[model samples]
Target: MAKEKIVLAYSGGLDTSVILKWLKETYDAEIIAFTADIGQKDELDGLEEKALATGASKIYIDDLRAEFAKDFINPMFQAAALYEGQYLLGTSIARPLIAKRMVEIARAEGATAIAHGATGKGNDQVRFELTAAALAPEISVIAPWRLEEFREQFPGRAEMIAYAEKHNIPVTASAAKPYSTDRNLLHISFESGMLEDPWFDPSATSNKDMFVLSVDPEDAPDQAEYIELEFAAGDCVAINGTQLSPLEVMETLNELGGKHGIGRVDMVENRFVGMKSRGVYETPGGTILFTAHRKMESLTMDRDVMHLRDSLISKYASLVYNGFWFAPERLAIQALVSESQKNVSGTVRLKLYKGNVIGAGVKSPVSLYNPDIATMEADPTKAYDQGDATGFIRLNALRLKVGSGVEQNAKK
Candidate 1:
């Protein structure tokens, strides 16, 4: 029988490093470390060498940044998805992309099982596993953080550090401030460690160090910067006058918004795993993308269609937040959302200053903004009718009038 090859999603972090070593020892298996680059920037630094040194037989560092932003991020932006009306789904959206690549690696490497470092209590476990199950159900999933043997052997970060030191695996994680962060072009998310406490004032110097994407709002440029974003069928296609790919748009906007302190959100969000977690996220690009997209929608989208879409927006947002990216229901919702955005092609001008994203102006070739119909000072001419509204209003209010008439008759 062949030794079971397990493709572990390794991050070169203490938890993943420990998982890699533990998998080799306990399962007596050949472990292939898999790392997905979804715009995590320097997080993928030296990951291959680190994985190999940490006892993995091989490593696959997958760069899915372009695909992530184009396929995943842009679609979510179209819905203006805000999980529970707060979280921007920066971390949540990245999880499925990473997991999708992990399953692909498992197939290519002929690995029987895949693994991750997500704890049992978090939403990421559900996100990663649901994706794997939806994509490749034949493969086995090994979640060591939830396993009894792994938990007893190496309980926490201290044990993982000691194990790394003993095994000669180099790591930057120490006992001091082990705040876990996930970064991408759109945002940087900080959680765990000192941030675990709900009441922990983020203003404290201790927690202040957790930020990576934005500068202080007060220190932001005194002048607000106005820029125009062009969208075609819900995806941002250009910035100012330059056309760019979806990925490039996100990267460009992130840099512009971050410098101006445009997207910083701190809130206690409910996890899909039936728990609440406190998280601080700086979603610079996403902030700009959503603001601009809505402005464009207002100019081009039909009023009735907009109202219908808005009614289902919360359900769509919840699905993405709860890790249903691959689910059929999400696909159905996305289809309708996409149809509504057919005329959402346009340019939206926005002003960015501090943490606020203010809308300036919006225009579209398919714009529904009829100046002649809406202008207050102009006559609508022979094409319009005012006397028709009297009957229209009376007919619509028939239910209320009939109820009142019946009450008066009964009293008499």
Candidate 2:
């Protein structure tokens, strides 16, 4: 008799590696390990050999970088999605894509169940399972972190290490570093461990060494660098006169922004799982793109439309943060966001200096700023009538005047 087949979302990290071996033992099933290459740099190195050695019957490594940048990151950026006005939703945004691909692989492989390494306490579990429920429905999800038996067996990283040694599973992770990290093309995030205390700053040498995307702002170069970004329909098309693919553009900006120590954020954020967590993020390329995109929109977007889209920013951001990427409301909101970007084509010059992305200049072919109307110097043709101001001011101030009069009457 053949055993049930299970597809596992495997990272070469300690948690997933242990889960790979444990799942096989627990289920006595055929396991297929899946890894999504969404620009985790060299972290994908030797992942296949590791998974195979750890008892995975087969391994699937899909290069999803282009799809991630074009389909996921671009749309989120178009909506200017930021959770709680601080976090750029880096880790939050990546989960749906990872799960989506995992589901696809599971379906193709005829696997009856899918498993992931996301813990019970974090948002990724919800993300992975929610996506599976939405997409695959009939597929069972195997989340070992939520199992009391599994938790008792592993307890912590130390026990997991011991198990790995006993099983002869190859792993390089140590319990010395108390914090956890997640990285991809868009950003790198650090949390848990010493970061759990709100007052604990990770500027110490040991903690600083954990940063993969950027350096300390104080250690950045003394000189500032300026670059221009070109956008077409709210998507960045060119950088500094060079036309590159989506991922290439991101990589270029990451290099430039990291060098100047741009895009470092530290905050205590509300998780979808009903908890507050402190996270430190370095989003060098994403920060540059966000800054440049906003400047470009200001140049070309209409005032009323811009305000309407701005009203949706929080809601759109929340949808992304809460793992609603495939939800109907998010799709509706994305349509509007896409509509607003029809004319968001322009060039924005930005100055990167010591962690700051400052807009130097913005220009668009369809710019709303009319020099003739805006100039302090009077135009010979008199396009603006100065006499219109008296009526405009009185009409606008009428409600204020009426309220003040009513208050005075009440006092009397």
- Highest TM-score scorer: 2
TM-score (C-alpha, index-matched) for candidate 2: 0.96
Name model 2 segments beyond 4 Å from true.
204-207
Pairs clashing in candidate 2? none
Query: Mind giving the per-residue lDDT tens digits that candidate 2 earns over 1-412?
Result: 8888999999888899999999999999999999988888888899999999999999999998888888999999999988899888888888899999988988998999999998888888988888888888999999999999999999988999999889888889787777888899899999888888989878776667777888888888988899999999999999999998888888899999999888899999888899988999999999999989999998899899989999999999988888888888999999999999999998999998998999899998889888888888896658888889999999999999999999999999
Q: What lDDT score goes with residue 334 in model 1?
A: 89
RMSD of each: 2.0, 1.5
Cα lDDT tens digits for candidate 1, 312-383: 888888888778899999999889889998889989999999888999998888898878666665546534
User: How does each model score on TM-score?
Assistant: 0.95, 0.96
Per-residue error (Å), model 1, residue 265: 0.5
Candidate achieving the largest lDDT:
2
